[model samples]
Target: MSLRPVVDEHECALHGDCAEVAPQVFRIDDVAVVIGTGPDELIMAAAESCPSVAISVIDESTGEQVYP
Candidate 1:
């Protein structure tokens, strides 16, 4: 499955957890930014690691949210 990650800037605390979990996929600047594609599991892991719950994962095939 193709996963797309969206970062909610307002909710982000700039903790860099998401980027730490998946550096290839996320970068930390003012907030976490989706930088590239990664394995489904890795993407989900990154989203789940966000302390502020700022990252949302979507299943590209279904256009449905798969992670909180």
Candidate 2:
């Protein structure tokens, strides 16, 4: 299964924790942005590390939310 990472701009705090966790997938600017995809583990780590809980992981095949 492929994982996609998404950042909620409204909830983002510019903490950059997600980028630090998965730089290849997420970038920090005014807010966290999804740049590209990485391994599922990396994506999940990034989402979990977000201090604001602004990052969410989705199952690309099922379109289901995988993480909070």
Candidate 3:
């Protein structure tokens, strides 16, 4: 299954950890951000690595996140 990256601009600190983990997926698009394709594990890592917890992941098939 595939996943999408939901970035919380408010909580994001632009730490670049997500970009580091998955450059192809996350990157610094100007002062803001941009993300690309990935899976749950990569998505989770990117989200968890965010010190501000600005990144969120939602499974496409299941249509669920790390929430209810």
Ranking by lDDT: 1, 2, 3
TM-score of each: 0.96, 0.95, 0.79
Compose the digit string of candidate 3's lDDT tens values, residues 1-68: 77778887877777888888877788866433655686668777877788777887777788878621
lDDT of 2 by residue, 17-68 (tens): 8888888888888888899989998899989999999988889999999888
lDDT scores in order: 0.91, 0.89, 0.74
Q: Where is model 2 poorest over a 10-residue stretch in terms of lDDT?
A: 21-30
Clashing pairs in 3: none
Model 1 TM-score relative to the real fold: 0.96
- Give residue 10's error in model 3 in angstroms: 1.1
* Candidate that beats the other on TM-score, 2 or 3, i.e. the better one: 2
**In terms of lDDT, which candidate is strongest?**
1
**Candidate 1: stretches off by over 4 Å:** none
Residue pairs in clash, model 2: none
Candidate 3 regions exceeding 4 Å error are 30-32
Better of 1 and 3 by TM-score: 1
- Per-residue alpha-carbon lDDT of model 1 for 1-68, expressed as tens digits? 89999999999999998888899999888877888999999999999898888999999999999888
Better of 1 and 3 by lDDT: 1
TM-score of 2: 0.95
